[model samples]
Target: MEIPNDSPVNPEQVTSAQERGNPADMAQSGDFNNSNSKKKKAGAEAGTSRGNKSFSIKLAPATNLWTTQKNGAVKLRMEETCCGGVSPLTVAQMFQETVNQCGDHVAIGFKQTNQWETLTFAEYYGECRKAAKSFLKLGLERFHGVGILGFNSPEWLIANVGAVLAGGLAVGIYATNTPEACKYVAQHCEANILVVENAHQLKKILEIQNQLPHLKAIIQYKFALEVHQPNIYMWKAFMKIGEKIPDAKLDEIMDSQMANQCCTLIYTSGTTGIPKAVMLSQDNLTWTANTAGKMVDIKRAGRERVVSFLPMSHVAAQMMDIWIPMKFGAATYFADPDALKGSLVNTLKEVRPTAFLGVPRVWEKIEEKMKETSAESSTLKRKIAIWAKGIGLQAGYNNMYGNTSVPCGFALANSLVFKKVRVLLGLDNCTKYFTGAAPITKDTLEFFLSLGIPIFELYGMSESTGPHTVSQKNYFRITSCGKTMEGCKTKVDKPDELGTGEICFWGRNIFMGYLNMDEQTQEAIDKVGWLHSGDLGKFDEDDFLYITGRIKELIITAGGENIAPIPIEDSVKSKLPIISNAMLIGDKRKFLSMLLTLKCYTDDETGAPLDALAPASVVFCHKHECPATFVSEVLQKNDPLFQKAIQDGIDTVNRRATSNAQKVQKWIILEKDFSIIGGELGPTMKLRRGIVLKMYKDIIESLYVD
Candidate 1:
């Protein structure tokens, strides 16, 4: 388990940028301090010791790979904020703090039976303890991992914390994963217990249970069915087992936990190969929670709220929806995964959250909705909308350049048009909005910015816990992923002529390593402590990180011209409303070509496929808004109009290319869209290049022929 030291940066030299409001602000704001006091009072009133003491850990000092500079190359870390000198070491400890301070506050909210259901902090903590006790009663060993296959639900969060509270590691399995994928994770982690959401997930486990030799029990949370299996247990019955355990024993088990112990195993999406189980320790979780909480300026208890709709299996959702709230005492509203497809907009309207985190696709959908609304508006209203947006874009530029003063004219324009747009999108109350998980086009970012809503793009992976670089509210670049987070140092390893290199990181928030894959782990993390991110990127003059593309994904043409496909692909999709996806093809070929898929939309009223052709332009809809049943018959690649539209889009993208090698010389409109079920898209909705290229080998070859 020893990590070899390789070019470690001096600890004394590593420092984070000064945060907007320091500890003095917390002291000056009596409300902030009073909140903590109230939490302790509430715990005492509830007949429970809040355990307000800090859980400290001695972090190993590792050298940073880059030096601190204003612009040339990114080698910087942010200063850490002292929170009463008590850093939480484990998820259980972090929850204990919230229980003590905000025991009566709403911790989790979800819809059930057409009504909103909520769990208070005290009740949530109690359920976690019960789940932990049940694990102990079931003879689950310390450090043993439990697999959870489900969506974003209150039960999923409870089970995750419960397993960790019981001194066992929790492994989250993506609900969309095939049975074989689920079995691989269970076997690899030696999961002793499996918690599934419903019959659909339970069926997968049952089919592959024989392969999981170490799996001792299966627990179903909802949609319980009649089963006589000896190892299967209903949700209520599972809780009953914990009720029998003495409270003293549960407390002892929680107290025995350590900061460095591994608490969760997050499996990567496996875009390139079989997914790898990432081992994240208690320290990694807590450090990210604390740091990200400050970076986002999360509100004090009772005031902050966020909607949880993303997959719970992903690290971004886990950090934002679960762990960060535990650190800051924020409330998380869980949107039902099944209902999310039909009701995400309505849910956001109802929740009106203070903070929101979305992937690029989510933001793109919102942008499309705005465009559609504009197109449908009256002539004068449409004209006014365009005018207001222009003014807002100017204001956004001012804000990006650190101008605090707003122009009176721009403010007037915002009140006239932008304000209504914000309210309609359920973003009126959102103060902190972020987009990550994949590269977002500048068009999407600018669209939101021009509407007076700033979407900060961040950079990180599961290996970095959640985010390593984030955009600040006052200082942000539309093209960059903000600055390095506090207590974390970043470096561009072996920069090329343009200064682009592999993005490397070393910090307290970095993951311990991949589970049971020592060689792979060692390869990822060098002899020193730096974790080598396969993503290629560079830092701008302001130290804002810009991700170019993946090293493995770089395309070298037959003419020996190096080209980054992401930019070219992103450009085509951004400009062409009809194209759903654009995959560039040119490796070892004389000229570059592309594979394009038409966008599909379902009629809002009847849920039937809508015609792609419009009066003057083609309209594309979000992937989620399109039903799987209608995707196959929506568009024909051989149609003249479709082919002409796609060709025009490719020509437009080519016009912006710096060299001929980067432009698409030919393109084929695909009959079908890339899908997760088809193994063309990853869990995060990113294109699987190898799979796509292989699947259309004939089409690709045809493009190269005369």
Candidate 2:
């Protein structure tokens, strides 16, 4: 109700509606215009229809819908989901034909230090077909499934396209996935060929190779620099086989690629449980990318040059790295292996990418940079910077999406101060700053938004083809996750008096269900067809959906009151200057608590510890005095940011609930952030809440103890 308030009504005085809104709106029949008997029949039908679906949209207020964002992004409104229409050229054709059209243009690349190994459209297509032919020579069938386990690189993407081009389904197992997890998917997919990156990756796959009956071929793209391995087929040797196929017939083979066939299987990181393989069809993927492209306008995409560092192993990265550029004929440049400071600066200066999509971690670093550099600056200077940020936001909105509400003086403010602010963050080249993979802290997103940097926070999962909803460039809000994609029917299943529930998605992009887990698939998608997202959400007066948290993850306490953890955690993280991520813990306990992580900052030169201005807009300590510690140290600082953040977290809970479900009573901070290597987080870097709870079981229990 405050700081980007959605509800016009005060949070304290809102009242709940009585009748659970009608689940269906049946057109009344002839004989009786809603008489008792007909009403009974109507009610029955409504109940049947609503059996799996949520409350009917006809009853919900409409203001909760998308209007606009400061991102300068335009919304392409569509009356229908463009399924079965222009029937997009399949992924393989899209890439090849684009390369054919833009032959000599540097189409894509992977980085090595300051240099880049480039591939023009022509070169890219040539490599794709040759690899495809070679894959066929290795005994790939029209229906064969090819699996890949690797880190992000051009090779990973090339092999994926080759599989699709050769009429094989590309199933990507998480490189971070365990041996048992890999075996399960490989066996279930019945993949015959496996393409892995290096010996270490291959070793993981080889551990369960004997258990996999269908796996017949294993090709390693990079040889282990350390030692020789005879069983693995070297990448260079494999390329030679690709020459065996006649070049004259390449086009003919690629044209036969079908759109409806399962093109890929990207398993979820399994933060919740066993990773479910999402069967992504070409039509589904093509549809999603095209839809998103229209919204972002990546075709006339201003920021044509992209520095892609996100994991290609994930769908979002694949969509951005492979699909977006192919659709727009844009040049995509890869950043160094490390998406951190040094490589980031080099890539930005060298490639000067026009557009960029970063997760919260990356953007937060930029925010941290602003605070660090301006540490000793006067209050007016910082406030002026904040004001200028608002101007930049206005200009960005006008430039990108064309809503253009900020008037002459506001416009003047942008030209004088905000424009330079954007360049400093290295976001001047960025046209659309996409925020996804996890919930972006609204405070952080707002800061970027105010600064004329466009940030789009979206919602989706591996099973939903990466995104079901995203904040439209022209129409967006800090609280809402934009409107649903054209055809998606999003609903809140159950509601307290407030009308929120388990989110259900039914759309063209919903995967062909989980791979091989037929029973689990059936359970996920009901008979009538609705992919249960498992996340809880509610739409506002504008029809924009605001997700709270996962239903299964919602902890019910001893008092039988259900508490959602994410909202509180998000508020806490957003308000803190140094806190990175937090996990909420209450479950069977009386009060909610949290496990926090502190972010380590670095000086501009060495990337070492540096001072960060607290939210008070005052610098607390210089490089020497900055303390690095856990929860105990944070409390000792007594800075305004810490107090504000902790208070905000509790206040958010109190404002949203009954007193029993208020802010957490206690919390602790861990020595480090959740990361993939430590297994506290997944490869995509989303925290595994369950895993954290287990790992810190004793630490979590202490708060409840006397």
Candidate 3:
């Protein structure tokens, strides 16, 4: 798809401002070459070739010393430095190395259905080899598309990396995708084979599998789980055949594909349309792993324990789960879907990971948990939390934007108040945290910091190799998405009071353009190769990039002041209990208003629900007074705990934006929760605001009709 020949800006956009601060300083820090450097560009650098390379996890210093069990079950015994290394390693090779050296090491701590299981490095590598060979035996050729459909599990990853071993690109479908959505991608990419875990996922693919005429095989991970059979291969029986392939030949076949070859199709989870299939080259994947590794400071020590819970189909989890750890041969514990509450907490205590990633939603849950349990703490405990949270936010800002102004008394505060706060959040053992994929409330963002968890908010898209801007260790601007990753150039197309504009990113990690759709691809990447992120941004006087909102999500009132609703919605929702999603409307008209969707957390099954609101008699505005989705019944059941949650949600967003653009007037109690299944959200669960506007067009009009 060719972009329309629209000349919006001058082609030469790489200004000194685009480079942010002293380019020389950043260059020294991140190995960045000046974009304005006199030298011309060349193709990617060929690192150590696979044959000459000992691509094992042991090479990373983090897992230098590991644990050896009496039963011959061994695992990584991490130290602080084990996870340290410049990353971006290939997943298949990481596994190869781990199995080769730490072959006996237990690599996976996975909980499936309800029971936990473990896979040793040797077993994990063997799994990938079989899967890869299975693909080849089933007719996978070089650069072929092998689609993956399922939730986060050992099987999901085994299939994804297996395809890589077979020299095929793994395109993961969101586990919750509708049949129609799945069909669109399968056909769009002309995938050669599709692998799924259970019968349910298979049912969705089977409905539309035939439409994907290019598909030659469908492999189900389980054996006994039978439904109406397709011309499919059972995973266990099929794997038996895969095991027969010689490992050396398998490496020969896959290695020949090279780093520049395409590795996966990462579908965009944009709210209003079919998700776009992001064509990631092997280089893109590795570069992302490399760039993100630098961003998070993934050291070899402690090799940073991580818990894999996010859907691996998306880039964040894919980077953290499938790519980053592969380079380090780090061990990741998988949370069980069933016993997630008890088991997730257990994993944190057991694994004590130093680094991890979470979405705003997950962080919110942690903040809520903190709020719920903190009430029972002593007065001194509460005071320390309040004081320490500010220092944490300052650290976050320092980590993101570059200028650091931590309070003078922080050392005293850290020792006195912040120490215990850290232990309560289970982040006591964690070094740093990554939260991204959507706007996050400042309160929640800072809360982790108060507890001594260095929560970093990052921003970017799959098109940009996962993350472009992230808070560095010393920078922390609550709203800034952090600084540009090393080797990236950023600029705002237009400036507001802040130097805010449409954030355009130019970097080596940018894609090789969207596959097949030359026009659309051309539209996204400008003439000089900057990927138009379509997100609004502003650099502070200090060169921090604050992501205001999506350009497409911008609402221009009749008065011409542009308001971004996310900050506002985030503020309001931060104070609310049981809010499923929030949509801020009233664009191109008068005052700002909103529509809120309220639903209980899936795991929040108790006598009193998270959906419960505060009493109408309280000083706080009830539905009768607020008129926002006034679910009186849910409100009547509201206990103090529930009320505090909702109020905190409200205060969170309210603290972010100015009053006019903030969620000033509101309505609540959407009929349904925003979900992938409900069409209210993107596959990643981001609210598709435009669809919500159109669906509730009349209500939005009513906000201004008077």
Candidate 4:
């Protein structure tokens, strides 16, 4: 039960210390490890290069930002006039600027005891500094990580910024991760302190605490600990630990930080293998927040408000919820933990944020819910909605195609139908709606457009910070990811006759190299500075970027015909209203086959797919004269009516195919729809193709069995 708080861990020891026990622990236990210190010194002399070209403006000399001082770790300036140019500033400095400008403005809001509570910018900043002191007091090593595993909350933000202010990296662990996955991230980052939401998340850490050699303590931020362990502490107690620590000590660590030094570690989904830690520097964060805000025209100070519900572990969520709000002095309201399951709409209505960001799945769910509700409306109301939607769709297309002429009856339609719908969904005040993290079908986009909601698309990955290209409300094509952000540049490498190739990114927002991953980092960033994104895309005459597919996700049939799966999948979903998920599977096979799942009810608590059909799917079945109420019943009866409907829809899609190889030759309905808990989707609700192909291997094999 002894707690090891005697020595500070070295960031250079992350890779080695995970395999071998903590070097500091060995030294304290009379097993002095001289070899570790030698290795650390060797790494320092070798130096880490992010391949960033020299900049005239360097913030400060790299000191103890990492155990091995890295060169080119202070360069945040690039020769670009985008977003009125960029500057070098640590996270601490950026946040302080906001506090100075809007000291009395509300920075964070959360519901407590069925009422709202708020925190001012200065008060929020003060709380973060207190957390930073506690981290330092708990022997948080410079450049070591503070792994936070929790839902989006004020405590999460405080711990994240506090870690950076204390000269450590802020690592957000997905709340849905397993114990083994949690161990990998914590061990990979050499985390000194762990923060969890409640007993459930705490159990994950307890199960793998032994494997995490550098984890010093575990703090539960949500509820009181029923049973206290040696190094376990409550939120209040943890915050008080560094009260006696001097302000000068925390300020000194902040002063030593550099803008280009890595301040955050975002882990990839690990669909292929172990998740890689994406190292985002202070400049990558601060610069992107300021510049992207400008690009989107994010309202300043109290004029902006956003509901924080998306998983903050993802770069998109972190940028939208934490960094952007800090830069603009906007208010962020924390949604309930079950926001993604079903309660999100209630939160949205109450908050009525000025801006909102939803992944493709989130928007799709909202679309489905609206359809279900509309089905139950009176005949006259439905007719009126239909009329309004037609006008709205026409007006939307007119605006998008650069026609300033608004369609006739547009104002009447908006006032009668669109206005009421927005108010009911709590989006009445929202001026901008963004969708990203996956490719959204044109069906979903047009559905929202018909309802007077233009959802902008964002394109980028963890390597590019968050967004490289963004589809703004003013200038956006129907399905394109829009133009690049002001200073960011995109190049399509090795384009074919159609100008389709891999997308590469270049800008100040480009991330520092992955943590402890040299070869992978080199592969990602070339000999020059461009970060080669392994995504296939093309640019139109207007310079708008369109993502075709991922390099790894592309399927090559046995006939040597290459096909992208997204378009085919989207076509199937659009043609068949009952189908919730569609995945094409014909790699190295004679012809393309598909795996489809019918829309079904899901457990509200766990998000587990249920056997009963959803309302929309049930309605579809009734319309087709099929009395089936569950997915199993449809298959058990071999319902020819339902089967023929699906077949006819697939036939329509096949007719539109460019070649025979592109057609879906066969398909089978899955018993359950894909869900995050089912291991078929990532946290952001993006389809996990590899996992799906493996999970249903026998079923897929049966389809192609001669």
TM-score of 3: 0.64
**Pairs clashing in candidate 4?**
none
lDDT by residue for model 2 (1-706), tens: 0111221111122211111111122111001012234443432332222123221111111221111111111111113546324444567655544554565556665543223445555555555665687787777776567888876666676788888888777877766566777787788677878888776877877789899887767777754323344434655556557566665455455556555546777766443455566777665677677776666657542227677777676787778787777766777766665665445755565555666777666677777777787777888878777677766656655754456566456766667566667555555555666766655566777677676676777777777777788675676777577778766668888776787888888665677656656677777776666678888888888778898777566665433234566666776776554566789887655567888766644355633333332333222222224453433455466556555555665566555432343467787766555666567877787778878889999999998785
lDDT of 3 by residue, 1-706 (tens): 1111121111122122112222344311211121332311110101111333554322212221111111111112112332222333455555554455555444555542223344445556656666788787777766667888766766778788888878777888877667876777778767788887677878888788768888888877643446645458666555656555666788787555544445777876533234556766555666567667766678642245578877777787888886776655566666555423445554554445567687766676667676877799899877776777677667545655555566667777778767656554455666777887667767676666565566677888788778888774666566568888775678887677656678898664566555566566777877655688888878877777887667676665432234566656665655654454677775544456667766543324422223333343132445324433334544455555544555556655655432233345545445445665546677776787767777777767766654
Each prediction's total of clashing residue pairs, residues at least 3 apart in sequence or on different chains, is 12, 22, 63, 0
By lDDT: ranked, best first: 4, 1, 2, 3
Runs off by more than 4 Å, candidate 4: 1-77, 82-84, 554-706
How much RMSD separates candidate 3 from the native structure? 19.2
| Native-referenced Cα lDDT, model 2 | 0.61
Identify the runs in model 2 with alpha carbons over 4 angstroms from their true place: 1-84, 223-231, 247-257, 300-303, 340-342, 376-383, 390-403, 407-417, 494-497, 554-706
What digit string (tens of lDDT, one per residue) describes model 4 on residues 1-706? 1111221111121122212333233312211112344533422221111112233333655432221222236244375484636667678778877776676677777664444555566657767877898898888998898999989888899899999999898999988777877888889899999999888999989999998899998888876576579898877678778878877777678777877788898887664345788888888898899888888889887788899998888899999999999999888888998997899988877778889999876887798889999999999999999999998999889888888797888889999999988888888888889987777779889999998899998888888889889887788988999899988789999999999999999888888777777777888888667789888999999999998867777675543344678888999999999999999998756678999999999999999999999998999999888999999987887788888999999999988664566789999998889999999999999999989989999999999786
Clashes of 1: 12
How would you encode candidate 1's per-residue C-alpha lDDT over 370-480 as one tens digit per residue? 788789989999888888888788789889998877766787788888777767766677789888776777888888888888899878989899899988686689979
Best by lDDT: 4
Q: Residue 482 in candidate 4 has what lDDT?
A: 88
Local lDDT at 479 for model 4: 90
* Model 2 RMSD in angstroms: 21.9
Model 3: CA > 4 A from native:
1-106, 112-122, 228-230, 270-272, 338-343, 376-417, 494-498, 554-706
lDDT of 4 at 374: 92
